[model samples]
Target: MTEEKYAGKNKPALSQSGVRWLWLAALVFLADIGIKFLVLDRIGYGWGNRIEILPFFNLLHVHNYGAAFSFLGDQAGWQRWFFTGIAVAVSLMLVFWMSKLPAREKWNNSAYALIIGGAIGNLFDRLVHGFVVDYLDFFWGSYHWPAFNLADSAICIGAVMIILDGFRSKPE
Candidate 1:
């Protein structure tokens, strides 16, 4: 909680100028989809088809029918709509949240924008392809991290920023 004096600056004021952040969000979203398009067009879907860039890094094509880490990926297919709905709702909430931030709060705006963009990108895939396209792959010896894409990266960064924003907004 913030003290009264500090709370004023942190309050959600519903400013109209917050729309500017939407541009960044759109850019992020478009870029994510664009990369997916390139991957799908250029790379074969075979499991063994991947480009190794380093000892632990690769660009591979994958599809996630579930949420993060392929959780619920084995369900009877309801997860497509389920996760899509969640992403849609979260994206809307983030936009509203952005609209309430102070117009000059660039960091907070950027954070919200990134989350919204990532959400929209994944949601689009769920609706159109019934799965989210993933390409980036990392591994260590026999353990491999789940494949992911830019949207996932953006969402993670945004989530961290939001957490940082919380600490920064605390009363001094």
Candidate 2:
């Protein structure tokens, strides 16, 4: 194929790349922040203020000071900046990767965009609150899972999509 065919309508390489899907990232980021702030405004923090929504779920405002599942949340400090740095670095790297992929690579593009969105969303929280805001709560019988927010969910979903993409059959 000629450069015209690859670039499409005289667009630049970056514009023709999977970066087109960045709108999805922006959407996820906006939605994540909107809900987080709304929760912050309406819900009182901690388990004692949980609002049960189902037999297995609840809306419980909480704060995570570390990585996923509160990996080092108990630390006096430092983990906050550490995770923030990771999020910033990962978001930038994914955006750059997306800019190199062809627009047709929707699967990988979307995965990258989702992760970028989620990473930036949490980064925003970390910068603004010094912690990640979590609200969704799920439990089974007497076992309760840690509360997490939409940003966390987006990151998990994006990661799962990337992992599943590895199993997809490639074109010859």
Candidate 3:
């Protein structure tokens, strides 16, 4: 297929670019950071300091030195910069994609904006704090899921939206 056919016929003008959706991304970033600071101020850090909100939920403050689910959290500390780099790169790439997309492509534009916001939110934490602050916790009986923050939640939701968009039927 030709490039135009594959990319679609939007040919958005400078003002019609999906970059308009950037406000959504900014909102996500602001909300994420705001909640994070609130958690830091109100909750003591670590599992032992958690405040149970419900049988299945709690508010706890903690730090993740690595990527999602603390992928390399046990590392000596290199993971901080590594994850930061990845977040920066991904946010830039998504913004570029958004710029090329049509303003009317709300679904994809929103997804891109969400991811960018989440990435930048976490990026801000990494740059200033040297770690990502996680506060929300969920548990069931003897099993507990990894703690995460608003930034992580936004990223996951955005990613799921993108995956679902892929399964949507196209007009052809």
Candidate 4:
């Protein structure tokens, strides 16, 4: 048992490669928040009304009071705390995972960072406003896609990166 403990302690922490990936996660988080403030806030929520960019896309503004698809939006009022707790927990786990990655696995670190950043962004909103502000509408004809914000987009992108990384060869 003592030998096993000593072995664990001797293991090197995240190498330079791993730190770089973690930085990428931080960058993604900053970018997500920056875009929201520069574009969404400047334009003002619900101010654009509707600007059609294509047959299936439009820029609109909307605030979300609940989870995806506004889930639990109408609930008594516990969801705000519930979602907030979950996001915080997830963010912590992602960061912890990023720190443990091998030095050569930059892509994996980046993916984890993206996820952490996005989750934190939304978590910020939940903590401050009791809801997240969402504004990005995509649709075709009468069908309407759920409105989402920069944080949501980042999370999705990160998820894709993670999936892609899984197919790549791991460092020896």
CA-lDDT, candidates in order:
0.85, 0.88, 0.89, 0.72
Candidate ranking under lDDT, highest first, comes to 3, 2, 1, 4
| CA shift of 10, model 4, Å | 7.9
Per-prediction count of colliding residue pairs? Answer: 0, 0, 0, 1
The window of 10 residues in a row where model 1 has the poorest summed lDDT is 1-10
- State the lDDT of candidate 3 residue by residue for 1-172, as single tens digits: 1368337575677588889999999999999999999999998888999999999999999999888888999999888889989999999999888878778889989998999999999999999999999998999997889999888988998999999998988665
Q: Candidate 1 lDDT, tens digit per residue, 1-172?
A: 3355235565555544465688888998999999999999998784599988999999989999888899999999998988888888888887766665555768878988999999999998998899999999999998899999999999999999989977784534
Which candidate number would show the highest TM-score if scored against the true structure?
3
lDDT of 4 by residue, 1-172 (tens): 1344224553337554355566665676677667666555555567357667788887766667788778888888799899888888987877766555555656766777777778888887788777787767888788888888778877888899988876876534
> What is the RMSD, in Å, between candidate 4 and the native fold over all Cα?
4.1
Better of 1 and 3 by TM-score: 3
Task: Identify the candidate with maximal lDDT.
Answer: 3
Better of 1 and 4 by lDDT: 1
Ranking according to TM-score, highest score first: 3, 2, 1, 4
TM-score of each: 0.88, 0.91, 0.94, 0.79
Say which prediction, candidate 2 or candidate 3, comes out ahead on TM-score: 3
Candidate 2 local lDDT, 31-79, one digit each (tens):
9999999999999999999999999999988999998889999998899
What local lDDT does model 1 show for residue 114? 91
Clashing pairs in 3: none
Where does candidate 1 clash, by residue pair?
Answer: none
At residue 73, candidate 1 shows an lDDT of: 95
